[model samples]
Target: MTVNIPQLRAFLAVVEAGGFSAAAADLGMSQSAVSHAVASLERELAAPLLVRSAPVRPTALGERVLPYARTALTAVRSLEEVAADAAGAMTGTVRLASTPTVSQGLVPQLLRHWREELPRITVRGFEGDSAEVAQWLENGTADAAILIDPPPGPGVQLALDGYRALLPRDHPLAGEAAVDIRDLADDAFLISPNGCEARVREIHRLAGVPFAPAHRVRDLATLISMVQAGIGVTVLSEVSRPLVPCDLVLLPVEPRTSRRLVLSGPRARRWHPAVRALAESAAGRLAAVS
Candidate 1:
């Protein structure tokens, strides 16, 4: 038998508000109707959901069922929102999060072109490390994101950027065609505190070198500045090369590894219109690339 939403709502309201009379007042229904709704729900489930108490309370079954009822109702509400967005020429704020490189190299151009498609929709952007971008998407702070090294399932791969070595111009290995991961073992390793640590460490492990990070900085520009001062070496994606300063040299890393640029949204909001648009825009842009 189907669970009646009105009856389920009534039961939850009574339990939450601590009395049927209060729930009835809050729901704008008569006390008798509220009681009948709960009663009807109990009958459908063949279970006793409420305790006939002084202030009213939930039975053991009611406590167990409350969370599922809330989840199902939340899903229904989200579906309604999706249907509403898709029904019209969508117009609303679309929040996006992305790594600093993509934020600089990709979004501005995309935003300029995107306005032509959904003229009324405003695109708001958040720039962060890939880790922070993913966190924003997961926590509902963003409608969509361009993430690097994304987890497999939730994202669509848009581009691939290989890891490259960032070295000081005067360093002994600066002119080398390629840098082996193990060659920099004794050198101080500057790293971005906000992102890419895991991948860097994995390469160190593969090269049988102990992982040692010398300077940890969140700002990419500052990190490159430190490299210019001969502070340490680091690895970053090739996509960030254009932003690199002249004093630093980027060499291809041996045993090549790549970071993926992916467009994704919250796992729960997979069908969100803004996220769908982001996926479409990213794919179309990549397709134009040689």
Candidate 2:
């Protein structure tokens, strides 16, 4: 039985788009044509591949088959490019997503170095919290991601870093060598909005205090801004401290609450060479900051 490239492409498109009509639009075909192709694929495989409900979800068989199809497609595309490169070629784009801290601090340095070393490889970065970064990797919107406190599962590479407290310049704790979480329990707390509240809760738990947040903001910049304004104190990764405004002081948090950073993609080590290169370069820059 011969595998049909068109059928496979159609199935993968449907899975990516989540509906036949959307997939058809993406593939430049009619909805009927997309439906026929998926049906043909299911017939050839002797199993139902898609669960055709409102959103048109993939079945377990489809989920298992989808990754292989994507891998095969990526390989085929790379082979075609290599063949074309027999004459001359050096350019490609690597799409990456990262948390705001990595995006603001580390990525710029890595991009500068990457441009000097691999002029042909362009690094395009998207910024979000950890959850958004993970979602981008899972949905194929990103070729790779630098995520903080990534949810546990397969297809992730863990990188660890320590946290520090951000305090206003005039705040009394700024003069301390290292302030423990318990030292600040009575103080008003500034926290990163919803997605990162867990980190604050962990700090409170470690300090044996209730996790009460007086204010919450979505990113480090905002949290630090609030700190500088004397709204409240918050803890964040050391990597993020540099990006905070100059008026704020970064102090080591005692007993050390650590942040786990993870680099993740669908293929892990099998990632595109450009992606791997960028990941390594970014890791080096982050290590230096740590």
Candidate 3:
């Protein structure tokens, strides 16, 4: 049976918007029109696609069909745009997944360059932990990922970046030219919620000391805030140092813990031009900061 686009749109709208009237409002059609479209879709498929209630719920058949409908619509839109671009036209979509700290710190600079250099390319950003970033890249949810301490995965490319230590300006170690991991062993540790635990533990193990975190934070901003409040000192990549406000001093850490910023995709060379461009730009930016 031929499924109509209008009917599919209405069905997806109701599934997204929860009720017939809300979907109608969003689609700028009357509630009756929305209802009729869903009915037509159900009739054509010879099944009840949705359960009518206070909030409309999708039937098993509806659940099965919804993703296909969404994917078809997305593919159609992408193809139409690609056709409009034709040959020699630089235009496509690039989805990037990165850790939250990088998302708040390094991504803005990269995105600024991307918008200027490739305005036609659509960019989507996902912020998560290293594990989540790696999962998205492996599962094909993201075209590329920026991560710290990412797990070993096939097709992943890694770049070594410099490190920074977040400490209160008045702290004794702040007066030193550079702080060493061993010097801070006695100090309370403030750790990044993601990947920091493992990295810190490894650093302690190497220093022959046991590591314990005094505070754990998910966001770079929060981690800096905690450090500024004298909660504890934490180490972060140099790229994230700029994200912290001036009230907190980010000192260079000596014998720096080498941090890896990983970039992964289905294939490094086969990535979309926009994705490749952004990845190169990110690497360059990090290198300059380092």
Candidate 4:
């Protein structure tokens, strides 16, 4: 089978974007072109890859072949980077994923550092909840990701920010230097399910406090707004302090708890050269500051 890079790219884009039109927009090609590429790929392979439904899902064969496709594309990108690196000017786009808080708090600085270190590499940002960010990295949608509490291997530790108790200005515990989770048990507890819920729950569990949150908010902004309006109190990372309104207070949990933020390339495939460069840049920055 003579499967070309364009056909592989078109297939992956279609799967990632969910439809030909969206894939075309992402790939900067016409819809017809994307369709022709995939069709040609199918013809060459002599099997249907996609089911072509409302959102366009992959068939069983497509599912099995997708990982190999990603591997092939990653390898090709690495080859291109090899040539660029030889000329001393690396150029490519690396899609980086992160949670909402990390995106807001750390991504700007990280991007700036990367730009200064690897000027030719364009790093695109993808923000999602923890699960979605992890999914993007696994599914080849992202070349690298800032993973929270990632497994210990093949990644750089970016930052370690502790989770803090969020309280309203007028709340009694708000003035304390460090508030115990048990101290706020009487208040209507709020939590965001975005990425930090498990950590929050673990904090509560360790403190012997109930883990039931009165409000399970999805958006970080809305959760902070709720706390500001005296709807309830919550716990969030210290990194999220900037997102909290001034009226809401963030106090260190009495027994401080922190989460590790790591930056790493895809777990399933070879690291794109730009991703490797980005990780090295971040590590060097951290080492310099330390």
TM-score versus the correct structure, for each prediction: 0.65, 0.65, 0.68, 0.85
On a 0 to 100 scale, what is the lDDT of residue 44 in model 3?
Answer: 95
The global Cα lDDT (0 to 1) of model 3 is: 0.73
What would the per-residue lDDT of candidate 3 be over residues 1-290, giving only the tens digit for each residue? 87888898799879867899988876779999999999999999999999998799999999999888776655554464456445645566777888877787667777887788678877777777777777756544566777665557533334565676778888888877788778887778888767456665666677676677887777667777888888889887777766777767777775557677776554422455556555665556666667
Superposed model 1: Cα runs more than 4 Å off:
1-87, 112-119, 128-132
The collision pairs in model 4 are: none
Candidate lDDT (C-alpha), each: 0.78, 0.74, 0.73, 0.87
RMSD of 4: 2.8
Candidate 2 Cα errors over 4 Å, as ranges: 1-90, 149-159, 280-290
lDDT of 1 by residue, 1-290 (tens): 87878987788779856799988876779999999999999999899998978778989999998877766655654675578576854555576889887886666767887787667767777777766777767755566888876667766786687888999889999999999988987789989867567877777777778888878998888888888888888998787787788888999987677878877877765556655665676567667784
Root-mean-square deviation of every model: 10.9, 6.8, 6.0, 2.8
Give the winner by lDDT. 4
Candidate 3, residue 261: lDDT: 72
| 1 versus 4: better TM-score goes to | 4
